[model samples]
Target chain A: MSSTLLNQVAFYLLSAIAILGALGVVFLKSPVRAALALVANFFTLGLIYFMLGNQMIGISQIMVYAGAIMVLFLFVIMILKDQTPEEDKSLFQDRRFIFGLLSAIVICGLIWALVINPTMQSFGGEMDRSYGSPQAIGRSFFTTYVWPFEIISILLLVGIVGSIMLAKRKF
Target chain B: MNTFLNLPLAGAVYEDIPLGHFLTLSLAMFALGSIGVLIRKNPVIVFMCIELMLNAVNLSFLAFAAYPNSHVQANNAFESAMAGQAMVIVVMAIAAAEVAVGLGIIMAIFRYRNNVDVDDMNTMRG
Candidate 1:
């Protein structure tokens, strides 16, 4: 059906953009550029989330990550002024980079062998009406996940306090 | 058919995307993130790579939640599926907290030294 074709087209296009953004994040020379690339990647990922039918999460991905978190990253990167050192040109010249590439290959291979084949055969059925709406997630949060919810709130508070302490001049 | 177009586009695509595709995308992103983590030396860049890894995992979690296991009991399906979304929410919260504390640590370190390179952080090795 044309609908399925449309879906595939959209997905592949987004995937391509997402991958490019990710690569840009890794390979770009400047910290600001890398952070900008990450922002692109996050935005693309949010769209993919929307395509997956979790509207609530998609919004969260954009707002929390692309909006707030990236801004924080930018602020720090600006303050620190991190740029690629000129002498460190050619990523291939570094032993650690080669080792890193090999390690990445091995890790991907292991995951594929262990996790991918046995499961992920195929998925079926359409998304239910209101599958991942805020209403549904909220309902689950207050009832089934209430304890974790409260714990996370406390964790956030602790994080705020700890960061303030770390930022102070003397401990 | 007119009726097909009348159906929400998300519903049509929703029924057809195999779980494998989502997982593959997630895996690729995770690999990219790992590479970034390994090769990048800047601490802030390293932190961004970690965020990449986290988002990759979040994609997988959402995929699984969207297309749950075929074998799950009917009555528990909603509950189980909801759990995955809930986990993703928890992860986002944790990531936010982590960024706060982590950036603060990095800033504190930068204050101690003129410039911050993670390699210079080996003073603890002494």
Candidate 2:
């Protein structure tokens, strides 16, 4: 089979898995179930990244989000240990649900506009291919995008300090 | 192999997959994630939804990185690929930090309240 056909097949198949898993994340009431669905969604997203030829991003997607972060989420939920004996029945029809539904619709419409708008269509075609490789990315990071790179490092440092502060009982 | 047989008709039009397709899928995922954030009362699920949205944005950024239009004049493939990949790496790093801090807050809240219900956060209101 031609390479084009291979990519197409891969994209749609993976998209199905992703969309369904995302739906599961929203619909499942149990935090554990939702977290599990999210793991599936992250894996499907990794496949999409792979198809886009950002192999490194795909690897990171799996390792960081699916493997580490999500497991952390699950562990926390488990430790929370069902504190409420009443099952929180009102959770089903709360005000947050209605508001969330509205926000979702608005977000979806806006995204569709950005994606399908004729003006965006005129922006041009495929990007330069060097964007896919490791060496090129490293050069760009140290050069034209150096400021943002440093800023992100600072952000991570702040996050580390902030979380420690927040988690500390007397800080 | 008729790989296109499994794909939608739009897949057949391009010799290689287009960045637009990735963007659209990413957007779809983002919207779903947005819904998840708004709809879920559980703080942990809300955090998961936020992560999903971040990943969606990352996908689009990677798409642009992999297929830059700037090199249309010279058709220089290597430079565009490198630029895109570089941006994705940076974004991933930022995302990791956000998750760490964000989840840490959730853990602290759970410790104090013994409840993860996001709606209960309204105590700050006057």
In candidate 1 the C-alpha lDDT for residue B94 amounts to 96
Considering every candidate listed, which one attains the maximal TM-score? 1
Would candidate 1 be rated incorrect, acceptable, medium or high by CAPRI criteria? medium
Provide the overall lDDT of each model, using Cα atoms, as 2-decimal numbers.
0.82, 0.71
lDDT string, candidate 2, A36-147, tens digits? 8989999988877766656566878899889988888888788776852223467558777678777878877786787544324333454343343456556777887888
Best by lDDT: 1
The reply for model 1, stretches above 4 Å from the true place, is A82-87, A118-120, B1-8, B11-14
- Compared with the true structure, what per-residue lDDT tens digits does model 1 show for residues A1-171? 576777888888888888888898888878899999999999988888878777888899999999999999999988877442232588888898899889988988888778765555655543354667899989989999999999999999999999999988663
Per-chain TM-score, chain A, candidate 2: 0.80
Please state the error at residue B38 of candidate 1 in Å: 1.0
DockQ of each: 0.57, 0.41
Per-residue C-alpha lDDT of model 1 across residues B11-34, encoded as one tens digit per residue: 345465677777778888899989
Per-residue lDDT, model 2, residue A116, is: 45
TM for candidate 1 is 0.92
Top DockQ model: 1
**Candidate 2, after superposition: displacement of residue B72 in Å?**
4.3
